[model samples]
Target: MTGTLITVAPTGAESSKAAVPALPVTIDELVATAKECEALGAAIVHVHIRDDAAEPTLDQGRLRETVAALRQSTDLIVQLSSGGAVTDPEADRLAVLDARPEMASCTMGTVNFGDGVFLNRWEFIVDLHTRMQDKGIVPEYEIFDLGQLTTLQRLLAQHGLPYGGHVHVDLVMGVPGGMPGTAAALVACHQAIRDLPAGSTFSATGIGRSTIPVILASLATGGHLRVGMEDTVTYAKGRPVESNMQLVARAVGFAQLAQRPPLTTAEARELLGMVAR
Candidate 1:
């Protein structure tokens, strides 16, 4: 917690460009978003690519191109999403590593995602972890509930440490079926994280209305922050988010106010064990 590590998840698999026109669905848009967010304060970009139709897709080619373009454009650590639309097949999801990103998201377990179930069976989780370790790709474990942290511990105990030897997690709260996005819940999650490996770091994301509350709670507890249009569309009660840059600027402002200004990309790379010491 030396400095706040702000991550920008510009676009997620669940959001639609039609619904949120500003969602970065194309490679050009994503690269632009990455550059702007990196300049604003974000050290990492948690990415989920879409097809020509602007729909969620785990296509390997598109994934590779996206990774390449982001790297060429910005210093932000590109993290691909392995939990592609709940409907993505395991093979395709696993194949995301073929893109060879610096980091990728590995959801610890499955949960009821709104109307559909975001399935992450034990075997699938193990496969994703082992593959990332093999490829030297660091993983940011996505924890939707408190119990998933326990599962993360078990995974480490059984399969050994992930590649890069650092354990980082993201608390995705306030989803319809996951943990609530409240200061109390964030504190509980923060406490539960102590059971994880020593020095493990985490970032909290509050979907929809819980966004600001979760951000404040995370900063107070010395945790990190992740923000973007992917988690929220409305910036306020009646005001819609203009773009991802607006969100990144807001996060930067918050970190500055907390006296924990955002970390640089190089610092973030070291923090995540991405660079060789």
Candidate 2:
């Protein structure tokens, strides 16, 4: 198997500093986290920025500054979250692509996120995909349920290939209302879309308790991994994670033991079809 691509999601739109104190909220904290995670073997940093008050916002200025700061501070591939928060406006979410990060997320379909719905309508998905293509931003398709795979198939069939023609996906499992985070679920997701996009690849992030299981399963299945506070806040049962670097170091250890060493920033860029920086 090729080297495993490790992506560290330092912060997410859902959590707060009050809930997860280690969560990086400011641009400086995010840059520090990205640099530490990169040194610990993470090739990519999945980012979500907040306002001065640490509340989620899709403000173009903040997004641009966060992306630029990350780019200047670390060699890791910076992937901005277009799925800002459940409450963010569609126009604002779509406008995030204007920051022009190396990559951005494009959720395949709407799914119940906890008690709220993450509304990604067909037209919205197509529009986001088209815009990402137009801006030369690579998309990491976020799959929260099995049926979304079919939606992804429809997307490719209808919209032609995404930007670079290299399809990459992230199986965001274990959301309360989405697919379960289990080996079976991960395997089923892979099986469903494995044959659709030619040379397509995927990574898995199991939220909460599903983290370790999904990590092991993704490695065993020849897929990559997405880890850190975005999907998990605990280092173990009841153990709050101290830093994103801790999760990344643990993943690198696991990948090494499995004989799939972690990919460097350069290798990950090549693997994901991103131009060298």
Candidate 3:
């Protein structure tokens, strides 16, 4: 309810550099994008590392290096995506924690991701949550569907609270197999969030064309925003997104208009219960 916590996911595992040239694939590109987004009011950088060929990778060495470089370059909360690629093995995905990021994403449930299924078995979800708790890495739960909220409650009641003791989630809307990005769906999700622990916060990201609609609905509903080419390549009809900063700036403007503005890096850390480094 203070200011919006804007998180910029510069590159995801799905896009290819050959197609989305603006996507930041290399560590240098990721650093540059993180710096720019931080300056544009983004408080967190949700990262997904790529191999030399610009393809998604769960290589532990590269992941560690990327985490170190981002920490050196920017004050943004470095959050590595534990859901690497739908094809990523459970061992590799769990090993993402060895990178020791300030925070990491933990998808609550499995959902269809385009043509492939993103499998998050109950055991896998509990393992991811328990490991994050043991490692003291804060988790930004990724909810892809409505029922996932129930799964989150079950996880919390059974396992215990995540590291940092703050519960924050990212609603990934409009995925072909997930919930829609309409205001109605967002409102329903938001309503469901009330059933969570008090002070729990949520941010929403709408895939592709659902970007602006989700942004508008999130702001109107007092939620945070996540934007980047990871969720959208086309800025508008027939117009391609130029850069991640473009999306961040637009979200900042919306937050400002809503009078929520954007939270600073330190403020974000405190809000999310992240230990200052």
Clashes of each: 0, 0, 0
TM-score winner between 2 and 3, please give it. 3
31-112, model 1: which lDDT tens digit per residue? 9989999999999999999999999999889999999999888888989999889899999999999999999999999899
The Cα local distance difference test for each model comes to 0.93, 0.91, 0.94
Off by over 4 Å in 2: none
TM-score of each: 0.98, 0.98, 0.99
Instruction: Give the deviation of candidate 2 from the true structure as CA RMSD.
Output: 0.8
lDDT of 2 by residue, 1-277 (tens): 5799999998898888988888999999999999998998999899988899999888899989988888888898989998989988899999999898999999999999999999999999999999988899899999999999999999989998888789999999899999999999999998986767778889999899999999999999999999989888989877899999999998999999899999999998888788899
- Across 128-206, the per-residue lDDT of candidate 3 in tens digits comes to 9999999989999999998999899999999988888889999999999999988999999999999999999999999
- Candidate 1, poorest ten consecutive residues by summed lDDT: 268-277
Best-to-worst lDDT order: 3, 1, 2
RMSD of each: 1.1, 0.8, 0.6
TM-score comparison, 1 vs 3, better candidate: 3
Question: What lDDT, from 0 to 1, does candidate 3 have?
Answer: 0.94
Cα lDDT of candidate 1 equals: 0.93
Estimate the TM-score for candidate 2. 0.98
Superposed by TM-score, candidate 2 places the C-alpha of residue 207 at a distance from the truth, in angstroms, of: 0.2
